[model samples]
Target chain A: MTAFLIENKYTVGIMLGVIFGLASRILMLRTDYRQYPTYPHGRIIHISLGVIAAALGAVAVPALFNKDYTAITFLTLAAQQFRDVRKMERDTLTKIDELELVQRGTTYIEGIAMVFEGRNYLVIMTAFFSSLFAISFTWYYGLAAGIVSMIIVLALRSGKSISHIASAESVPVKQDGPDLLVGDIYIMNVGLKVNQELIAERGLGVIIKPYNPNGKATLSNLGQRQAILYDLSTILGVYRDDGEPALIPMAKLDMRDGRLAIFLLPQEKNASKAREIVLRVPILESAVRMPTEAKVNQQEGS
Target chain B: MGEIKAVVTMHKQQVGGGAPIFVADNVKQMEETAFLLEKLLDAAVHDLKNGTFILVKHK
Candidate 1:
């Protein structure tokens, strides 16, 4: 090796190439494998390819710097590794999501690689390969570098297409909307902060009413209005002690995040005139599946 | 327990010929309770689809 370096001073550059190639491969193996480990078989393929790539770069890069190589075996090996890495990507998605190719699948490996960006893998491979090219033609290394850079640019665009397909294959999307039954909902008070408020009930004295100081308050000692709850679907019908109905529209209804909250007031009150009326909203039974489906029916224009 | 920020309870109902039950809870417990229910439903649906729903006893 010393004799070879003495014969050609450029051989020193080949050492740098070998060092960079091995470093890139080690970095990729250490970081990338964890992101997609479901396909242990694919992991083996990628690692072996990286090893072969680094080894080929080690020999070819120095030989090329020394202006040797009876046959461009290292270049050929590097290309083969890149090609295999590209092919391994498809094997990762062996688990079929759906018959239509757009449904969700639990054990999707290709989708995982796509999420991490396949082109980045290619760019890393090309960076390793570039060291070999640098050894071959010291003057034309600039041109070789530009060519690989173009491939990286092109791979990025292809990665986007892969991402679209992979995302469609991986994500579990439901077609139907959420099951929301709004009625007979009673609000229960889970104690929040309380404050004193002057109460005036027509002829009644200035009795102090326990008011929840923050809007983040729950109803206290509340029981469900059974007759109303059983029949309710979306609208909460608030009634006074005398059974007089007050219209309350549910402002937010989500069971997973919390129980539904309804803003109630008289039907005659407009936006400016509406007074704050809080009611015990009914606790939603968590039987309904696909809660996120509710947002699908909402106005898209908003 | 400090100041009683919230209290939640589940309401169970038997339905669909099996002892498949539904849980009702207040807002504080709604989110987590619903997620658990969704998981249960997923298993139930999988069982029903595969004709294994009969093999498992009700909880």
Candidate 2:
């Protein structure tokens, strides 16, 4: 048994590597409340790529053992290939967003694309580690290594949500004549009395207060604001149709205090649920600005 | 993000335009005309508060 294991160590190591790599990819590919990657077709495309990534990672160790120096070039080629995947995701998502009622803004789409590309790299890393451990020690060590890498990858997958940087609460959606206000922050003008009444009846308002200058700067980004609205509407269901501009959701800044006020007309008018959703909105990576980190502001921030 | 596509006003004297305009006889007539324009145009009505309602199409 030991002789057989020693003779086919590379084969067993590669199998373990591919298995772990594919598992991580499948685990990361979730079509949850976000409903991203769009079911069967999208799932198939990503999974096929995962297989290729896994194979590349697994074979690298054997190639190095054979002293085949040219094999390192494949990894570089894979990086280029993965980058194209990011571009493909971005282009497709941007095109789809144009037709959405509550569009997933560019920041959100870019984040998703980055996530996809990052996950592929993670799979490669996991496969490499698992294969390395398998060939260097035993197949059992490879399993342990795979599990450890999977945990780390999953842990790193999620970034900060709104609650991490700010506090969110339900506020009243009020109107002073023609002006729509989320608390004291004016959202927009509602000209028609009928539409105003509808908004009054159906509108859900939220106020988000940032904890620091960094949070404030992030929230102030238009892309981030649009992402917040997009997520809120997708989960809570927007009470709007195409060309019905009066029923549109809006987020406005209270420039004085760096507070944000959001006014939404959701199909479901549950305040607590809306508040929960607001807190859970993923902070966009591009929108995150650490203004306090600047040398000029560091002294004051500290 | 929005462009005023049409204007419905009680005071014909209040507005002039690059966009189309509809003049109404009274407040009730102005409201009715604006409401019709809002539905027909599938736009938002914004009260200028000078007896004018502008129908805006938000893209």
Per-prediction TM-score, chain A only?
0.32, 0.97
In candidate 2, the residue pairs with backbone N, CA or C atoms under 3 Å apart (3 or more residues apart, or in different chains) clash, namely none
Candidate 1 residue B8 Cα shift, in angstroms, is 30
* Predicted structure with the largest DockQ when compared to the true one: 2
Proportion of true contacts reproduced by candidate 2: 0.81
Model 2 clash tally, residue pairs: 0
Docking level for model 2:
medium
| Model 1's TM-score against the true structure | 0.30
On the 0 to 100 scale, the lDDT of residue B25 in model 2 is: 89
Q: Which ten residues in a row are the worst by lDDT in model 2 chain A?
A: A1-10
**DockQ of candidate 2 compared with the true complex:** 0.78
Question: What is the Cα-based TM-score of model 2?
Answer: 0.97
Each model's lDDT comes to 0.32, 0.91
